[model samples]
Target: MNLALTVLNITAPVFLLAAVGFAWVKLGFEYRVEFVTRMAMTLSVPCLIFVALMRIEAEPEALAALSLAALSAYGIVMIACFALVKVMRLDVQTFLAPLIFGNTGNLGLPLALFAFGEVGLGYAVVVFAVMAMLSFTIGIWIVAGRGSLKRVIQEPLVAATLLGGVFLWQGWQTPEFLTNTIDLIGQMAIPLMLITLGVAVARLETKAMALAGFLSLIKVVICVGAAWLAATFFGLEPVAAAVLIVQVATPVAVTSYLLAEKYGADAQPVAGLVVASTLLSVIALPLILAFVI
Candidate 1:
């Protein structure tokens, strides 16, 4: 009973906030998704990553282990997803990226924060940062047929992650006033991302429900397995291991559909993925949390 309540307590706020956005859109409210996404990506999320890394209480070595574990897990997932796509004869451009990359930002971050507190948030940010770097570079390459290192370098989140690493490595702290200001900005990231996720799902149109649902199930299974392997191999501490598993097993990111639309690679299928996987997460994530937590 306590365990069930704990899982519910951790998960309910996340879905509730997303529900608010979903309801807002269903009621015909105007929520500019592009603007919110840009602000969150360019400003608030970067601040959140920087502050979390800068203020994290975990030792630098432990964070490093988690980083390597995250990278390994992503690599394993990519291979597994690619093989699945090839075997199923799905479009490499549309299916591979969505299957490999999950919604680490919108869903994973808040769950980690609620389930494991600040320390979990710290570990979650590490995985999110790793995933972001790959999504901007390799993920874009998969969808667009070309990768741009310059674009990756120009992303504010990447810069923040790098800078934050430096601060963490040197045991440096920003001035108190500056820290508070940045933390305030960082605070906007989670809600903005969650609401934006809901808004995007509401706006997306998808017809490939059966395929998307099957692939989403496969994705969760593969990702959970990969993350578990990586965490065990890297010897991640309990919280870090749990965070990695949850983050890696998160549902398809809404950005996958946006990327498909922008790159002209069958957006509808990707949209189906986003919607299907997200809806599945409503049930999947809480169960995963129950096991991990």
Candidate 2:
């Protein structure tokens, strides 16, 4: 109940503001939605990442869980999702790359920053980094079904992850005063992203929304189930499992919809998936958190 209320309190204003803007545009503020997405992407989201990465502390033990699971567990799920995509001969739009790759940075990051705080998030970043890189290269290949390996290689998301890894490896924590500033900016990331998301959903048609909803269920169920079994086998502690589950269980990355739209890969369904998963995550989060943490 506390968690539910917290999500409501945080999400309501963000969503309502976006809905109003969307309605205003429909009422005919067309630029308002664009403004939100741009601001969030360029300014807010990056700040959120910088702040979270600088402060988010990964313990040796928690990091161990990540290292051990990389090849065995995470690898297995990635391979399985690919196999399903191949065996079922699904549409390019329904490929596992985009649906399964997830949105750990924008949506997942803020949620972790709030729900678990600094220490708990460290482990989550591990799973996050893997999918973060793959989302552009492998995920785009799955979704686009065209050769863009070079473009994918140069994706900004990929660059950010790589830079972040270097900084992490270099142990370059931010100065105290800068940390304060970054957190304040980072706090804005979600509201702006959510507002953008709500507007994006408002743009989608009914059929698209329905398709997205169906895919959203598949993504979450597959991810959470895989993460749980892996955590169990790895003998992950409650906290370790909790971190990983959140990494997998987060809603489709808001950017997934953007990518779909850009790549002509059924954008509306992806939008629907993002919106539905986010709404349902209210219920889903606590259930997963309890089992793990």
Candidate 3:
């Protein structure tokens, strides 16, 4: 009973903030997703990642273990998702990327923060960074048949991740004033991301929900299984293991829909995936948290 409430305490704010965005959109309020996303990605989120990585309280060895565990989990998930897509006779370009990459950024970051606090966020950032690199490189390649290394290099968040890792490795700290300013900027990341997630979902229009639902369930199972196996194999600490599972098992990101649209794949089905998987997450994340916690 206490555990249930604990899970609720952790997840409520996440969904509630998202709900605010959902309701705001439904009430005919104006929200410019493009501008908000650009600001968050370029400014707020990178700041958050840099600060989190720089100031993470976890041991270097533990952090390193989680990083490798996350990478292995994602690699295994890619293979599993590939086989599943082929077996289902799905459009590989449209379906494979969505299945492989989950919503590790907007959803995973906040959940890790709430469930396990700053240290969890630190671990989560590592996983998020891994996902970002893979998504831009291999994920884009899967959907577009030719990913651009130049495009990935242009992402500000990627630079932030690399710099942050360097800082963490060297036991470096920014000046107090600079750190405070960056911390202030970083503070916007979670709320903005959650709200943007809701807004994005509200705007998506789905098709083939039945297929979406089935695939969504399959994704959760595969992600949890793979992450758990990887964490155990790599002997990640408890918090690191939990964070990896949650991050990897997050639902299909709304970005998947945008990618499909851009690459000339069928966007409607991907939209269905985004919606179905997200709705599934409201229940799925908490249950997983309960077990992990």
Candidate 4:
């Protein structure tokens, strides 16, 4: 009973905030998602990452281990997803990236913060940073047939991760006033991201939901299994392992739909993925949290 309540307590606010956005859109309110996403990714999320990484006191060895584990997990997932796509004869351009990259940023971060507090956030950010870097690079390549290394370098979130890592490594702290300001900016990230996720889902149009649902279930199983194996293989600490699993098991990101639309790779199927996977997460994430937490 206590465990169930704890899981609910941790997840309620995150989904409730998203529900607010979903309801707002249903009421015919205007939400410029592109603007919100740009601001969050460019400013607020960067601030959040920089602050979290800068302030985290976890052992450097632990952080390094988690980083490598995350990388290896994603690599393994990529290989597994590739084989699945081949067997199903799905489009490499449309199906592969969405399957390989989950919604580690908007959903994963807040869930981690609520489920495991600041320590979880610390580990979650590392995974988010890794996903962001890869999504911008290889994920993009899969969709567009060419990777944009320049775009990856120009991304504010990438810059923040690199800079925050340096600060953490050197044991440096920003001036008190500056830190406070950055902290304030960082505080906007979670709520904004959650709401934006809801808004994105509410706006998307999907077809082939049956196929999407089947794939989504497979994705959850594969992602969670791969993450667990990677965590155990790498000997990750308990918190790190739990955070890694949650991050990897998140739903297909709404960004996948946008990329498919932009690259002419069949946006409808991608939209189906985004919608189906997200709806599945409503049931899937909480159940995963029940075990992981």
Candidate 5:
């Protein structure tokens, strides 16, 4: 009973905020997704990452282990998803990236924060950063048939990650006033991302629900398995292992649908995957949390 309540407590705020966005859109309100996304990505999220990394309390070795574990897990997931797409004869450009990359930022970070507190958020940020780096580089390549290192270099998230690492490594602290200001901005990231996720789902049009559900199931299984293997192999501490599993097993990101639309790669089906996977996570994430916690 206590565990069930714990899981619910951790998960409720995430879905509730998302529901607020969903309801906002359904009631015919104007929410400019592109502008919100740009601000979150370029400003708020970078602040969050930098602050989290700069102030993380874990040992540097632990963070390093988690980083390598995340990279290994993602690499394994990418290869497995590629094979699955080929076997199903799906369009690689449309399906592969969605299957491989989960919604680590919008959903994973908050869950970690609620479930395991600040240290969990720190661990979650490491995984999210790894995913973001790959998504911007290889994920773009899969969708557009060419990757741009220049674009990756220009991303604010990338800059924040690199700067955060330097701070962590050097045991440096920003001036108190500056840190407080950045932390205040960072506070906007989670609610904004969760609401944006709901807004995106509300606006999406799903097609081929059956196929999307099946693919979503497969994605959760693959991600969970890959993350588990990597975590075990890397000897991650309990909280770090749990965070990695939860982050990797999160549902298909709404960004996948947007990328498909932008690149003209069957956006409707990708939208279906996004919606199906997200809905599935309503049940799936809580259950996974119960087990992991």
Candidate 6:
């Protein structure tokens, strides 16, 4: 009961405020949403990631648990999604983005912070990093149906991951002044992300929104079941497994719409999925946490 109450206390206001922002845009102030999203994705988000990575104290046991959870949650999901496309007889591009493009970084990262603090997030982020690589390079390739090897490897986030890995591996300490500056800037990620969602929601067409809602429902069931089962089957510790599940349980990534739009890979449904998933994720996350933790 205490744990449940703590979860509610932390999430309730955040949920309400996000709803208010979404409603405000739906009623009016659509432009503000776009501004927030742009600000968050381009600037604050990267800083937040960098800081999170730097702060994670890599212990051998927890690190191993995190890796196991990440691999189990993400690896299983990706494989299931691949098989799903063939089974459903769906177009690869249209269906693939909905299945795999989870908001693991933006929304998932914050939730991890809330649940596991930095320790939990460290595991979640590593899982997200793996998913990002697969989603961006392989995901984009599959969606586009034909992209150059260079194009696949050259995405901004992919490059960031590669560079960031080197930095982490080098064990070069980030100066306090730099981390402080990044934290100041990175603090903007949450608000910026919220406003962005609101604006994006306002722009969604009615039919597309309906489809996205459908996908969001599907995502909730799939993510929760898959993550929990994977964690259990893999024998991960409860808390570590919960982090992986939380990251997977998040709705579609905010970046999914942008990727779809940029490549012309059925942006309308993708955009709708982002909105629906974001909303649905609140319910989905708590349920999974209850079960897993």
Off by over 4 Å in 2: 1-35, 67-74, 82-89, 146-171, 208-214, 234-237
Q: Lowest lDDT 10-mer window, candidate 6?
A: 155-164
Model 4 CA deviation exceeding 4 Å by range: none
Candidate 5 residue runs with Cα over 4 Å from true position: none
Off by over 4 Å in 1: none
The lDDT for every candidate, in the order shown, is 0.94, 0.63, 0.95, 0.93, 0.95, 0.68
Q: 89, model 3: CA deviation in Å? A: 0.7
The digit string of per-residue lDDT tens for model 4 on 35-79 reads 999999999999999999999988889999999999999999999
RMSD to native for every prediction?
0.8, 4.0, 0.8, 0.8, 0.8, 3.2
Candidate 6's error at 213, in angstroms? 4.5
Higher-scoring candidate on lDDT, 2 or 4: 4
Clashing pairs in 1: none
- TM-score winner between 2 and 4, please give it: 4
What's the candidate order when arranged by decreasing lDDT? 5, 3, 1, 4, 6, 2
Candidate 3: residue 188 Cα off by (Å): 0.5
- Could you tell me how far off, in angstroms, the CA of residue 8 lies in candidate 3 after the best superposition? 0.3
lDDT tens digits, residue span 162-239, model 6: 555556656655788987998899888766665455556556653466766776787677777788887777677766
| Least well predicted 10-residue stretch by lDDT in candidate 5 | 146-155
Looking at model 3, report the run of 10 residues with the lowest lDDT sum. Answer: 58-67
Across 83-155, the per-residue lDDT of candidate 1 in tens digits comes to 9999999899989999999999999999999999988998999999899889988999999999878888899
lDDT string for model 2 (115-146, tens) is: 66675555555666666656656677767776
